[model samples]
Target: MINSIKTPNRLVNEKSPYLLQHAYNPVDWWPWCEEAFAEARQENKPIFLSIGYSTCHWCHVMGRESFEDQGVAGILNRSFVSVKVDREERPDVDAVYMAICQALTGQGGWPLTLLLDTKKRPFYAATYLPKNSRYGMTGLTELLLKVSELWKTSRNRLLESGEQIVEAMREQDRTGYVQEPEKNLLYEAFSAFAHSYDSRFGGFGEAPKFPAAHNLLFLLRYAKEENPAASEMVLHTLDGMYRGGLFDHIGGGFSRYSSDEKWLVPHFEKTLYDNALLVMAYLDAYTQTKEPLYRHIVRKTLDYASRELTAPEGGFYCGQDADSDGEEGKYYLFIRQEILDILGENRGRRFCEWFGITEQGNFEGKNILNLVENANYREINPTMEHCCEKLLCYRARRTFLHKDDKCLTSWNALMITAYVKAYLILEENQYLDTAQKAERFLEEKLSRDDKLFVRWREGVSAGYGKLEDYAFVVWAELMLYQAIFDIRYLKKAVRFADTMCDRFFDDTEGGFYLYARDDERLILRPKETYDGAMPSGNSIAAYVLGKLFKITGEEKWRERSQKQLRYLAGSSGRYPAGHGFAMQAFMDALNPSQELIALSPEQEDLRKLRKLVAAKPNLTVVVKSPENGQELAELSPYTKEYPVTAGHPQFYLCSGNSCAASVDTLQALKW
Candidate 1:
C-alpha cells in the first residue's frame, strides 16, 4: 500500500520564510497553490487558508498552539484542505481575503484565518484563534468542528454566502467613480487630523499607535505661514516617537509600532518599510525646522539599516523578527544590572539614569532604554553617540535575532528614496552613492528582460512585480535623476511608468490594481488606495504620474493622474488621514511641481543651486553640467534650446511653459 501521508507537506520547497516556518507542522499544510485547491475539490472539503508574515508574533503563537498539535492537525487533515500563504509574498491574495475579514469582523490583522468553499470563495474569516478557548475567544478546535458541521449540514447556504461576499466586495470597489477632489479637501484632511491629534502623546489616537509617517509628511507640506498648527503636529509627533522605546536608542532603527499610546512599549518587530518612511519623515521635519535632532535620527536610522538590514550584495533585507530565543523582545530588552555591567559602573549608571532605565523596568522587569523623561539626548549626555556604541556592542553578544533576508523590490525602492532624500537635504554624497548601489542591485538582479521582479533571495528572484514595485521604482528613479542629473535614470523612470500603466492600470476604472490582469492566482484583483503602514501602490502611482508630467511635460501623464485623483478624491478628501498619500498626489496635481534648471559645470555652484531648490516644497530641480547638455536636452526636450547664459553657471526657474530670466548667481535665483 502506498503511503498517503506527508509530514512536511509541500511548503518545504517554498522560498518564503513564513511558509517554510510551517513546513514541519504536524498539519499537512500546502502552500497557496492550484494543487491545494484541487485536493480540496477531490476530498470534497472546505479550504482553510491562513495568511501572515514571518515576523508576526501571533502567527508564531497560532502555529505553536494549533498547527503543531497532532489532534488539531488530524481534524484539519481529515475534514479540510489547509493552505498557508505568506502575506508579504502574495499580498494580492491576502488583500482580497483581508477585505472580507475586515468587513465581517470590523477589523483585520495578521495570522488571518479563513474558510473557503472548493470554488475558492470565502464564507468565514478571522485573525489569531487560540488553541483552547479563553478570554471569551473561540478555540481553533471548536471553530474547526463548527465550520465542518456547517459545511456538511448547510452546504448550499455556505456556498451562496461565499458567492454573495465576493460579489459584495466587487460591487463596493466599483461604486466610487468621482472626478477631481473638492477645493476644500486638503483643508478638511488637515482639520480631521488636528481634531484627532494626541496633544500629550504627539501621535493620533489611543493605544497600539503606528508611526503614520506619511501623514506627517503631508502635514509638513500643509504647514504654510497660514497653517502653523500643521508643522506643530508634525514636530510634536516626531519628538514623541524618537523619545519613546519604539525607536532603538542603541541600534538606531524604529520598531513596527508602539503597543501603548505613550510610545513606551513596542511590538519589537523592525521593518524596512517603517524605517524607510520614518527616515523620509524625519528628513522632512529636519528641513522644515532645521532641527539637529531630526537630522541625527535620519542618520542613525539609515546607519542601522546599512549595518544590520543590508545584504553584502547591496540589496536591503525585508525585516527582523520580534522574537529571539523563542521569546518576544528577548533581544531588545536589557536588565538593569546587565546595562551596568555592559558599561562600567559610572558610565552605565549615568546612562541608565539618563535613559529612564531602572530596576523596576518599563517592560516586564526589563528596561527598553527610552528618553521619555529626558527627551534631550545632548542635554543628558553630550557623549551619547559614544555611549550607544557600548550598548550596541553589548547587545550584539546576546542571542541573535532572526533577520528576514528577502529583498523586496517595493521596500528596497523605498529605502533608495529615503537615501536620496537624505542626500538632497544633508548634501551627503555617501547617502547618494548608497542609493545608487541599491538601485543597481535592483536593476541587475531583480530585473529580467527589462521587466522588474518582486522578490529576491540568495541571488534568486521570483514572483511577478506588483504595482508597488513599479510605482516605487519609478519614484526612486525620478529622485535619482534629480540628485545626479542623470538622463538615463529619467528615461528609465518614463519606461517603467509606461510599463506600470500597461500592466496594472484598470482601463475602465481610473485606479491601478495591486496585481496584474494576467496574474491568475488571485481570485479577485484588489485596488488599494488607502495609505496603511506604507503608502498604497495606487497612491504612489498617482503621485509619480504627477511628477512625471511635471518633468517631461506630458499632458497624457497629467490626464491619467487626474483621472486617478478624481476616482479616489471624494473618499480621500473626506478622510484625509486615511488617504494621506493620495491627498499629497492630489495637492501636487493642483500645483504643478516647480523645476529649477541650473546649467552649472562647477560642483560647488551646483550644490548651492540644489540647496536653494531643496528649500522649496514639492519642487523637482535638475542640475546639469554643461558637458552633458546634448544628452540632457535629448532626454528633456524643453531644455534643448535654452543655452548656458555665460561661461559661468546660470539658473532658470521653470513652471509650466514659462521660464524666468536666467540668473548667474544663486542670490538672484528667485522662487
Candidate 2:
C-alpha cells in the first residue's frame, strides 16, 4: 500500500498549481524533468505520463477516483514511473503527446493518460479512466496491471510500437506540402462555417459549445470584405453567447463553454484567454455595427478580468476553477430562495424574471442566471445593475472560488491586445493605461535578458518562451505601438520578432515550431496550425508578420509572412473552419491593405487620426511628431519621408506599391 507512507511526493516542490494539487497523492509523482526519465530508465519501468491543467474538472475527477486511492496508487508505484504535467505550464510537451493520442484514438482531451517507454515515446494513450472497470470502459488499475505484464513479457513489441508512433509522427510532419493560397480558400472556409452555423443557438455544432472568438474574428473580416450576410452569423452568435448562461450575468465574465447547444449550462471555468479573445471579438462587433450591446459586453468582460483574474503586479492570472468545495459550479450556482432572501420580494422576483432564474432551477436544483428567454433584457436599468452588485457581494461571502494565479505570457499578451483594442474603439484612457501597465509587467517579470518566458508565479518565472508566447507578445507590442504611437513598443516588437524567427522558425517546413530550438527537445517537434479555443502560434505569427511587413516595409518580414501563409494554406485547405485565425491571416494577405502615416506637430490632429485608423480594419497607422520623428524613422524607415506639417497633419496613404498624394484633412484621405 502506497498510502502507508504519509510523506509527500516529488510534486510537493513544483511551482505549478496543477502539480501542487497532486503533491499529497498516495502515488509517488514526478514533475516532468530529466531525473524522472533517468529513474524510469534505471528502474526499467514504463513511464505513466499524465497531462492536465489545474482548472480542468475531469483532471480533478480522475485525481479523486484514481490518484488518491491507495490500491490504484500501489499498483502505479510498483510498476511505473508516474509523471505529472500541467498542460498550461508545458504546452510543448502536451502538444506532441496530444497529437499522438489523437492519432492513436482519433480524439484528445484533458486528463490525458499515456503509457510511454523509458525514452518518453508513448506506446498507449487514452483520456480518462476509472479506478475499476465499469460501463464497458477499462479502468486505470486494470490497464496499469496489463501494461506492467506486457512490459515484462512483450517488452520488444512495446518498444517497437513506440518507435513506430514516433516515426509515423515525423512522417506526418514531413508530409505537409507548401501550396499557394488562392482567393477561393477564403470562400471555402466561409462555406464550411456556414455549414456548421447553429442557426438557433448562435455557435456551431452540437453540445458543449466553445466561444471560438477567432472564428468570429475571421467571419467579421469575411463579412467586411466579401459577403455582408456573414455578419449576421457573427452577430447572432455574439448575442446568443451574451444571453446564455455561458456568460456570467451577475459577475461579468464568460465561463469556458456551454454544455448544451442553447448555451444554457456552462462548465463554469473562467479563463483569461477566453475572456481576452471574446473582448476582442465583441469590440470588433461594436466597431462594425456601432451596436451599444456589444460595447457593453466588452466593458463588462474587461471589468471582470480586472476584478477577478488580475494580479496586483498588473499581470493577468490563468483562470478560476469550475469547482468550489469539491462540487462543480457550487460557487456559481444560485438557488431561487437565496436570490429572494438577498434582494427581497419585489426586486428579487423582477430580477429572477429578467434572468431565467426559477424555483425548479436548471442545474442540479440550482439556477444558473441567464437572459435567453427575455428579449427586453437588453434595456438598461439601474435597479438590475444594483441587484447584480449585491448578489456578487453575497456570492463572495457564501463560498470561495479557487483562482489559478499563475500568469502566462501568452494569455497576458492576449489581454493586453484586448485592452488596447478597447481603448482605441471606446476612447477609454484607463484601458490604454491598463494595457501599457500589463506590458510593463511582462517586460519586467516574465522576460529575462530580452527573452520571454512562458509563465510567472510567486516571483519565479519558468519555461523558455514558446511560439505562442513570442507571437502573442509581438502582437501585443505591435498593438501597443499603434495605441500610444510609441516608437519603443514598435522597436521592441521588431527585436522580439527577430528573436522569434531565430529560435522557433522552421526554415525548410515554413511554419514556427511549438517550442524553440534552444528549449528542451521532446519526442517530436510540433508545428500546430489548427486553432482550438485560441488561435494557433503559426496563425498569430502569420498575422503579426503581415502587419510588420506593411508597417515597416521590411522585405524579410514580407518573405516570412508569405512563407508562413503558404504553409498554413496547405493545412487549412481541407478544413478551413478549424483554422479560422490562419484563414483570417490569409484574408489579410489577399486583401488590399493600406498603411497610413500621419504626421503632425499638433497633438490633437494626430489624436483624431488615431481614432479614424482604429475604425478602418484594413488600415495600419503610424503617427509621428517633430519631437519623435527620428525614433519613428528608426522603426519604420519609410516614415522618415513623410514630413510633419506645423499646424495641419499630413497623411500619406500607401496601398500595394503606390502612394497617394498627401492629404491634410482626414476627409480628403479616401479610405
Best by lDDT: 2
- Model 1 pairs whose backbones collide: 180-566
Give me the overall lDDT of model 1: 0.85
Number of backbone collisions per candidate: 1, 0
What TM-score number comes out for model 2? 0.98
Against the reference, the lDDT scores of all candidates come to 0.85, 0.90
Worst 10 residues of 2 by lDDT: 601-610
For candidate 2, list the clashing residue pairs, or say none. Answer: none
lDDT of 2 by residue, 1-671 (tens): 12436678998888998998898898899999999999999999999999999899999999999999999999999999999999999999999999999999999999999999999999999999988899999999899999999999999999999999999999998888789988788898899889989999899888889999999998998999999889999999999999988989888999999999989899999999999999999988998999888888888899899898889999999999999889999988888988999999999999999888999999999999988899885676678889999999988885677788999999999999999999989998989989988999999999977799999999999999999999999999999888777889999999899999999998887999999898998989989999977899999999999999988887899899999999999988878878989887887888888888877725666577668757776778878888788887876788777777556677888898798998877778876
Cα error, candidate 2, residue 550 (Å): 1.0
- In model 2, the Cα lDDT at residue 278 comes to 94
